[model samples]
Target chain A: MASPVFRGKAITYGDDVNTDVIIPARYCTSFRAEELALHCMEDLDPEFLKKRRPGDLIVAGNNFGCGSSRENAPLAIMGAGIACVIAKSFARIFYRNSINIGLPILESPEAAQAIAEGHEIEVDLGAGRIRNLTTGASFTAHPFPEGIRAIMAAGGMVGFVRARLGVDAPAQPGRERKRSQG
Target chain B: MGMTIAEKILAAHAGVPVVRPGELYFAGLDLVMGTDVTTALSAEVFAQMGAQRVFDPDKVALVNDHFVPAKDIAAATLAQTMRRFAERYGIRHYYELGSSGICHTLVPDEGLVSPGDLVVGADSHTCTYGAVGAFATGIGSTDMAAAWALGESWFRVPETFRVIFRGRLPEWVGGKDLILRVVGDLGEDGARYKALEFVGDTIETLPMAGRFTVCNMAIEAGAKTGIIAADDATREYLKGRATRHGVYHRPDPDARYARTLEYDVSGLEPMVACPYSPANVKPISQVEALPIDQVVLGSCTNGRVEDFRIAATILKSRGVHPKLRLIAIPGSQAVFRQLLYEGIVAVLAEAGATISPPTCGPCIGGHMGVLGPGERGLFTTNRNFKGRNGHPTSEVYLSGPAVAAATAATGKITDPRTLMG
Candidate 1:
C-alpha cells in the first residue's frame, strides 16, 4: 500500500471534548456508522454535521474524547467524512478506538495551538509531518508504529484481520453456509 | 524491578515472566461483561467476524441492567438481541431484568470476578472490580467481541499513580469525597492511561462497598484502572463469594510509581461535582442551599447497602420536600433484599421516596427519574456530563448519599453535617 497524505480545512474545538458531546447516549441505539454520523457533534456544535466537508480535519485542545468508552464517538467522526484528528492530547480509550477504527489521530500540542478554524492543514501519515497552510507553519509528531499504520491504511482492524486471515468480506445473515450443507 | 499490583496481574495473564509499563501484551481475560446497550453491538461484531462459538461461554456475562423493562421499543429490541446471543452461545452468566442488577455490582456479588484476575467489560465503569485487587478495565464493544472470540485482548501496561490517604476521615466524609478531591486536583484527564493504586491506612479501614465507590470513578480521572491491594477486608468480602481462592497478587514495597499523592482526610468536607463536569468540584458547605428539583441516590458507584443505609438514617423521621422527587435504587437484588430486611426501604418509602428495582435507570437517562428542562438534580451517580440525565439544559450535581438524602429533604443541596447535628 502507498503512504497517504491528507489535506483539509480545520475544525477547531476546546479541551475535554467528551464522548457525550460527540454523540449523545440517546442516539446510541444503532450500530450503523452512517446513522451515527448524522448526529455527530450535534450536542456541542449543532452545525458540525451540516457544515462538515469530506476529508475535513478536526483540531482540538487537550483531553479530546474523554468520557465514555463508546467506539461510536470515533466511528461517528469517521462516518462524517473526517480525514484525521489533531489534538493536544487524547483520552486513552478514545486514542485506541480511533486507531482500531482506522481514524488517523496525531498528538501535537504545537499543531493544535497553532491551527485555527477554517485553516488548511496537510498531514503526511508516513512522515509524521504536518503543515499549516494558513499559518505558514509546520510541525512534526511521533509517527504511529508500523503495525498501527498498516491497520489504519487497511481502513481498520476488521479489514486488517480479514485480510490476514485470507477470508472473504463479512457475510450477510441470509447467506447459505457451507457447513450447513455439509 | 518491583512490579505494581496491575503489572503483576497483567504479567500473570500474559503468561510472561515480567511486564513493564508502555510494553504491549495480549492478556487472557478471566471475565468479559457486557451490558444491554453494548452487548447487542458486540454480538453483531462477533457474528460478523465469522466466529463459530465463544472461546469460553462461562467467562462471559451478559447483563441486562442499562435499560431494563424496556424504556422504548428500540431498547426492547436491543435487549432481545442480547438475550438471543446469550442463549445461542450458552453463556453461563446471563441475567435479565428482574434477576440482574448493574453490571459492576452484580458481577462481583455473583462471584464472577476474583482477585488477581483480569477482567474486561464493555461499560466504562468496569474498573469497579479493581477494588478487589483484580486488574479490571473497560473496553469498547469491538474489543469485547475480540475477547469473546479469542479469550484475550491487548493492553499497554499503564504506569501506576500511588495515592495514599492518611488519617481518619471526618464524620460524614467518605470515599465519594476522597475521589472527588483527587479528581478536582488532578483535573479530568490527569491520570490518562495510568493506573491509580489507592493505598494507605484509610483505604485499609474502609469497607468493601466504599472501596468499590472509589474505584468506580477512576475512569473519571481518565485512568485505565484503579487498584487496591487485596487484604483482610477484601478476603472477608470475597469469602464464599469468590470462585477461586488462595494467594492474591499485591504490589511490592518498592514498586515504581509515576507519581505519589498523599492526602489527609482529617479535615475533609463532603464534596459535590457541580454541573457540566465531574472536575467542577467544591466543598458541600459552599454549594449548600442551592435549590434542586430531584435527587437520585443510586448507581454502580454508590448504590450499595451501606450507601442506602446512610440515606435511610437521615430520612428516618424526616419527610422529603413536597416539591422534590427523590428516587432510591439499590445496587443489586442482594442489596435490595438487605435493605428490605433491615427496614431501610421502609424508611425511604415513608419519607416519600420512590424505591426502584436495581437498574442503571436515571443514571444513563433511561427512565424513572430523568430530569426535565431547566431542572437541577443532586445525585449520587457518577458522571455529570451535559445531558447525561435527560435534557441538555438540565444540571446535575454529583454527591454522596448523605448529601443527596439531606438535599432531598430540604429541596436544595444541603450538608449532611447540619442534618446530623
Candidate 2:
C-alpha cells in the first residue's frame, strides 16, 4: 500500500474540548454532513467555521472528543474539511469513531503542546512521523496497523467491508456476508 | 502474566490465551445495542455495507429511548427506521416507545447481559454494563453497523487502572458521588482508552443499583469501561433474570495495571459536577448556592428505582420550590412500574415533581424538559456539557438523586445531608 501523508496548518485549542460543542445535540438528530459543518464548534469557538481553511488540522490538549458518542462530532470535523486531528489524547469512543469514518487522528502530546496555532505541520500516517515546519520539531506517534490504514484508504469501513465481501462495482457492499437472523 | 477481568473477557472472545494493552484483536460480541438516536444512521451504514441481514437477531437490541414517544418528526422517523429494520431482520429484542427506556439500563434490566460478556453499542453509556462484570464499551454507529454484519469488531486491549476504595459511604453518598470523585481526581482524560477496574470494601457492600451508577459514568472520565467482578451481589441481582449463567471472572492477584489509586470514601459527601464539565466536580458543601430553574432526576445514570427511592425520601414531605420545575424519569418501564407500584410516583407528584414515562428524553436535551436561554438545571444525568440540555446559554449541573431532590425542594444547590438532618 502507498504511504499516505497529510499537511495542514494547525488550529490549536486547549484541553477537554468535548463532543457536545463539536456538534451540539440540537443538531444531533442527523443532517447532511455539509449542513452539520455549519455549526461545528459554534458553542466553543464561534469563529471556528470562519477561521478554518480547507485542509486545516485541529491540534489540542487531552480528551479532544470527550463527551457523547454522537458520530456527528467526527463527521462535522471531517465535513469542515479538517484533514486530521493531532491531540494529546482522545476519548476512546471518539478515537474509534474517527477511524471508522476515515478521519485520521494522531495522539502526540509533544506535537500538540509545541505546535502553535496557524503553524504548518506535516504528518506521515504510515510512518507515524510528525513534522512541525514552523518550529523545525519532529515527533513520533504509534502508526495505525496495516489493516486500519487499508480501511481508511478505502474510504472507511463501509467501502472496506464492501470490498471484503467481494461485492463488486455492480452492487452494494457485502451480499455474500449475509445470514438469516434468528 | 496476570490479567484484569476486562482483559480476560477480551481474550476469551478474541480466541486468545492472553491479551496485552494497545494490541488490536477482533472479538466476537455477545450483544450489540442501538437507540432511536443512533440506529437510523447505523441502519443506513449497514445497508451501505451491502450486508443482506444482521449477524444475529438475538444478539442485537434496538431500543427507542433517546427521543421516543416521537419528540418530533425527525425522532419519529428515526424510530420508524429502527422498527422497519427490526421487522425486516426479524429481531426479537426491539423495544418500542412504551417498552423502551435508556438503552444502557434497559439492556441489563432485560437480562441481555451476563458476566464476561463482550458488548458494544452506538451510545457512549454502553459501558454501564461493566457493572455486571462484562467488558462493555461504546462504539460508533458505523462500528455497530459492522458488528451487526459480522458479529465482531476489532479492539485495542486497554490497559487497566485499578481503583481501590476504602472506608464506609456516608448517608446520601453513593456510587454517583464516588464516581464523580473519581472523575474529579482523574480529570476528564485521566483514564483515556483504559479500563477502570473498581475494587474495594466500599464497592462490595454497595447495592447493585449503586454499582450500576458507578460504572455508568466511566465515560465521564474517558475510560474505555468501568468494571467490577461479578460476585455474590452480582449473582443475587441476576438470579432468575438471566436465562444463561454468566461466566464469573476475577482479576488475577498480580494483574498489571497502568495505575493503582486508593480513595477513602468514609469521609466523602454528595458531590456535584458544575456547569460544562463532568470533571469539574465539587463536594455539595463547598459549592455555592447556585439557584436552579430546573432539576432532572433521571437518565441512564441515576434513573433506577434505588435512585428514585433516595430522591423520594428527600422530597417526600417537602414540596419543590414554586420556581423550580422538577422532573423525575424512571430508567425503564420496569423501573417506572416499580415506582408506580410502590406509590413513589404519587409522593413525587404531590411534592411538585412531574413524573414522566421512562425515556431518555430530557437528559440529552432532546425534549421533555429543555432549558430556555439563561436557565440553569441541576441533573442526576451525566455530561453537563454546554448546550447538553437545551439552549447554548443554558447550564447543566450534575448530581445524584439525593442532591437533585434536595435542590428541587430549595430551588438551589444544597447538600442532601443538611435536608436530611
Candidate 3:
C-alpha cells in the first residue's frame, strides 16, 4: 500500500495558543462544524478566515491546545479548512481529541521551529515524514501506531467503531475490519 | 521495575498482568461521566456510531452544570437532549438541575468513584478523581460516546512523572499554592501526556479536600492525570462512601518515571496566576496592590465546603469591597448544603457576598458575573486565559479561597495572613 501523504500551506501560530482563543466558550455550547469554523481564530487572529484556504494545515509552537477539554477546538480548526496540525507538542486531551476526530496531528519540535508561515509542506502519516516544500527542510515526527492509523483511515472514532460493529449488526461483538476511506 | 499507581489501575482495567508506556490497549471503563455541555454531542456521536443502548446504564452519569439554571433557550434544549437520552437508556446516575452542581465534584462527592478504578469523564477536571487513586482522565464527547457503546475504549498508556511534595505546609498555604508552584515551575506544557504521581510527607498528611485540589489542576500543567496512593486517609474517606470495593494500589519504590520533581512547601506562600494564563504565576507577596472588579470563589478547582469555610472565616466580620462584586459558590449541591448547615452561607451573605447556585458559570464565562472590557477579576477557579471570564480585553487573577476572600475585603490583592493578625 502506498503511504497516505497530505500536503497544504502552513498556517502558523505561537506557543500555548489555548482553547478559549481557538473556540471561545461563547461558541462552545454547540459543536456543529460549520458554525464553529466561522469563528475559529476570530479571537486570536481576526483575519484567519481571509488568510486560510481549504486544505491548509496549521504549524504552531509548543503546547498548541493548552486549555479546555472541548473538542470544538480541533473541530473548529478542521471546520476552518485546515487538514493537519503540527506542533512542538500538544496538551494530552487536545492531541487525543484531534486524533479521535480523524484530524491528523504531529509533534516535531524541529519542524515546528523551522517551518515558516504560509510555506508549503507535505506530511506522511505512515512514514512520519514532514517535508517543507518551500524551505526544503525535512524532519521526522512520531507517527500513529497501527491501531490509531486504522482508526484515522476510517475517518475517526465514530466511523471506525461503526465499521467494527459491521455496520450496525449486534450479532457480532467487535473488531471486524472493513474497508476505510482515503 | 514495577508500575506506578496509574499504570496498575490501567493494567487492571485492561485485564492485563502489566502494561508499559506508549503502548496501546483497550481498557474497560469502571465509570463514564457526562454533562449538559458534552452529553448532547456525545449522544449524537453515539447514535451515529449505531450504539442502540449503553453498555452499562448504571455506570453512566449525566449532570446539568455548565449552563445549568438554563442560561437560555439553547442551554435548556441541551439539557433536554441529555435528559431524554438518559431516560431512554435508563441511565440511573442522572442528576437534575437542582440535584447536582459541577460534574467533577458531584461524581466523587456522591461516591461514584473509588480508589484504583479506571474512570473517564467528558470534562477536563475529571482528573479530580485521582485524589482517591483512581486513574481518571478527560476525554472528548466522541470518546465518551465510544465508551458508552463498548464499555471500553482504546488508550495509549502515558509516561509517569512523579512529583513528591516535602516539608510542612506554611500557615495560609494550601494545595492550591503547591499546585500553582508546580505549574509555575513546570511551565504550561511541562507534564504533557504524563501522569503526575504526587506523593511524600505533605500528601500523607494532607486532607482529602487539599488532595483533590492538587490533583484537579494536573491538567493545568498539561498532565493526563495527577494521582496519589490510597492510604489510610483514603480508606477513611471511602468508608461507607464508595459504592464498589475500593482497592488501593501502591507504587514500587523502584518504579520507572519519565522524571521526578520535588518541592519543599515550608516557605511557600499563596500563589496567584495573573492575566491571560494560568502559568503566569507569582507569589502573592510579589503581587502589588492591584485593584479587582470581581471575586468569584468557586468551580471544580476550589469550590469544596472547606474552601467556603476558609473564605467565611476571613469574611466573617468584613464586607465585600465597595468597588468589586464577590460571588461564592459551593462545588456541588452537597457542598452547598454543608455550607448552609454550618451557617457559612449566612456569614457570607452578611458579608455582602452574592450567594448563588452551584454551577460553572463565570469560570467558563457561562454567565453569573462576567467581566467587561478592561475589567479585572480575581477567582479561586482555574484558567485565567484571555476572554475566559468575559471580554478579550478583560483580565483575571487566580488564588486560593483565602486570597480571594482577602482581596474581596480589600478590593485589591491581599494576603490572608495579614487578615489573621
Ranking by TM-score: 3, 1, 2
Q: In model 1, where do residues sit more than 4 Å from their true spots?
A: A146-154, A160-182
Q: Write the per-residue lDDT of candidate 1 for residues A121-166, one digit (tens) a residue.
A: 9998767789999889999976665556666776766665556444
- Clash pairs for candidate 1: none
What is the per-residue lDDT of model 3 for residues B1-421, given as tens digits with 9 covering 90 to 100?
8998888998998899899999889999989999998899999999899878898999999988998788888888889999999999999999996789888788888888999989999988899999999999999899999999989888889999989889999877898998998988888899888899999999999999899999999998988899999889888887777878788899987789999999888888899998888889999989858999899999998999989999999998998899989999888888988999999999999999998899999999888988898999999988999888898899999999999999999999999998887
Evaluate fnat for each of the predicted models and list the values in order: 0.40, 0.77, 0.69
TM-score of candidate 3 to 2 decimals: 0.96
Model 1: how far residue B226 lies from native, Å: 0.1
Model 3 DockQ reads: 0.64
lDDT (CA) per prediction = 0.88, 0.89, 0.89
Expressed as tens digits, the lDDT of each residue in B1-421 for candidate 2 is: 8999989999999999999888888899999999888888899999999999888999999998888788888778888989999999998799976777888888998999999999999899899999999999998899989999989998889999999999899988999999999999998888888899999999999999999999999888889899999999899899878877989999998899999989999999889998889999998887848899999999999999999998888988899999999999999998999999999999999999988888888788888899999999999999888888888899999999999999999999999888889
Model 3 docking tier (incorrect/acceptable/medium/high): medium
Task: For candidate 2, give the lDDT of residue B393.
Answer: 94
Candidate 3 off by > 4 Å: A1-6, A124-127, A168-182
